[model samples]
Target chain A: MTEHTVKSFDDELTHLSNTISRMGGLAEAQLAGALQALANRDSDLAVRIAASDAQVDVLEQDVQHFTVRLLALRQPVAADLRHIVAALKIASELERIADYAANVAKRSLVLNQQPAVKPVGAVINLGRLVQTILKDIMDAYVEQDVAKAIGVWNRDEEVDDLYTGLFRELITYMMEDPRTITACTHLMFMAKNIERIGDHATNIAETLHFLVVGTPLKGARPKGPSVEAQ
Target chain B: MTEHTVKSFDDELTHLSNTISRMGGLAEAQLAGALQALANRDSDLAVRIAASDAQVDVLEQDVQHFTVRLLALRQPVAADLRHIVAALKIASELERIADYAANVAKRSLVLNQQPAVKPVGAVINLGRLVQTILKDIMDAYVEQDVAKAIGVWNRDEEVDDLYTGLFRELITYMMEDPRTITACTHLMFMAKNIERIGDHATNIAETLHFLVVGTPLKGARPKGPSVEAQ
Candidate 1:
């Protein structure tokens, strides 16, 4: 390969990474905005948060096109091939994370109209933890830090635990005051959406682990089963 | 390229598709088993369904490894490249669909411990519809039938509509008889899990469309918002 062609290949690879990084940043901010809208009961902000998911969707498409072009043109092998594939998978994960956040925001709109349920604070707390996990996993992706990725993977259990506790609490609340069932059910799904975001973050962590180490993440994920069982 | 090498590549591609077809079959059966478990309150079948998800996970990993090797070795372009990528993405979707089925099965175990809820029949109906959608989409994938794929895509709205009605029915049932709150909540999540399976089937349908047409399915999805909003 000519030196000019090699240099151009590096530039294209970097462009693909940059597009994915930008997409990750957008997804993180979207989740943060969704959590804030839920906490403040700001229906207008929730509407905007839900609408902005389209931008993340577009970025995902950009990553897909760029990666396909890179694979076909560059024909990268070994580590480079792994990196490209990981980017593709991670972009899909981020898109779903953003979708879950939008679902949270949409549910928050309905939750806002009803009288406040007692467990709204717990829901917000769960969302905040997932938001932090998203930020940390994205950082791990950029840095290619396997240890940090493992740290993020392990912490999904904490999200699941919080979700299980909140799940029981919400059900008990509904049982005590059947009037609150409508609002509490919304809270239940909101918390479940947040829990799913944490799962996606863990998925990104595993993808990063494989990108750097060239092997699947060792052992089963820390998750046992769906929290709805508890 | 030598003719022998070309023939081997064709064989490899066929192997990849066959693996995915097997994975799809397993996922469909898993959902079928989960729905049966729910309908009969069969905890044993539910346990078996939950445990069987690991096989689907293994098949997904197989697709990932196979696709990566194909990309690095074959360096396919144009339609072949799209087919490989779509298989990777569709495998991920099938894996998630199976995970949702396992979740429904796990939740069924918990629901079985409690008294039966009135809306269990409605939840089973929703699951049956999604199960049919899953089967149809997989057929579309195997046959590469775009019209059939589009049919699967449009039918997601039916799943959403069923889920919305069931959501209200379950909530009203809980409100009317708070004693069934625990069981009804489980049914609500089971219904939501089936609804998400429909969404993933829609995703696979879109993936199949893109594989055949080299373009995304046009226009927005028929979905409006999270059913929790209603």
Candidate 2:
């Protein structure tokens, strides 16, 4: 390729990465807002977070369109191809992360109507951990830093541990007082959603590993506790 | 391109679809076996179902390998491109569905240790419903039938309703007898896992719609009662 062609390709790649960054920013904000809304029992903020998911959805569609166009038009080989494919997968994962946040917000809308539960602080703290992991993974994508991505991947066990603890606490609360059952159940699902968000971050980390190394991550993915069995 | 090249391309497409079909079949069987194990309290079958998830993971990697190669090599446009992309997404969704089945089976291992809850039958029934939906969606994928896919998509509400009902029943059981709380809680998570499998099936249905019609399905995705809030 000529110098101009190489420059334009680089520009397109940068553009794609920028779009993902924007989506990531939106997802982070939405997640933070959702957690805050849950903590404060702010139904209106929760409603806004739910509505703002569409912005992320539109951004994801843009990423898809641009990535597919680059793949077909440029027909990039080797690392470039892997990069585009990873971006595609990462965009999808981010969109789903946004959806989980929105779902949490929606639950908050309902939970707001009930008396607040004691475990809300734990849920918010879990959300903070997941949001930080999400931010780190997106940065890893931008910087192509495998170490950072792996760091985020390893931290998922912390999220899972918190989820297990929260699960037991919620179950115990529900068992002790029948009145808290409905609210605690909602809290449990939100905690699970946050746990799932952590899983998606690990997925992005795996994709980044493949993109960088041109091979799948070796060995089994490290899992903490099985939420289902708990 | 020559006619022979086109023929070879078509052959590759067929091979790709066949891999997906095998994956789908394996996933279907895994879900069925998991539910059966849950019903029979057969920890051996449950253990096997858990072990079989690796098979689905291998198949998914195969699908991913073939898909990335096709995208880079053929540079298929329009419907062909969409078909390959949809196949990639569907394979991932199917693998996740298998994971959910495995998770349910794992939960069954714990639940089986205790005396069976009366609501175990309800969990199995919900699993059966999700399994049928999964099968229908797979058929929709094989046939590329958007209408059939939409039919399956519409039925997710039914799965959600059943899950909501089952959630309430499990909570009630736990409230009535503390002895049943451990078993019922595990069952609740298993039920939620099945519901999530239905959601993944719906995701495949939406991907099918995009593959066939070249546009996302319109309007909000149909959601039943919010599990968290209920």
| Global lDDT scores for all candidate models | 0.89, 0.86
Model 1 stretches with alpha carbons more than 4 Å out: A226-230, B226-230
Q: Which candidate should be chosen as best, given DockQ against the real structure?
A: 1
The per-model DockQ list reads: 0.49, 0.43
lDDT for A212 in candidate 1 is 95
Candidate 2 colliding pairs: none
Task: Quantify how close model 1 is to the true structure by its C-alpha RMSD in Å.
Answer: 2.0
- How does each model score on TM-score? 0.95, 0.93
Angstrom error at residue B48, model 2: 1.1
Task: List, residue by residue over B1-230, the lDDT tens digit for candidate 2.
Answer: 99999999999999988998899999999999999999999999988999899999999989987887888789998889988888888899998889988999898988888887899999999998998899999898888899999999899888888888898898788777877777887887788889889998999999989999999988777884363421
Candidate 2 residue spans exceeding 4 A from truth: A213-220, A224-230, B213-220, B224-230
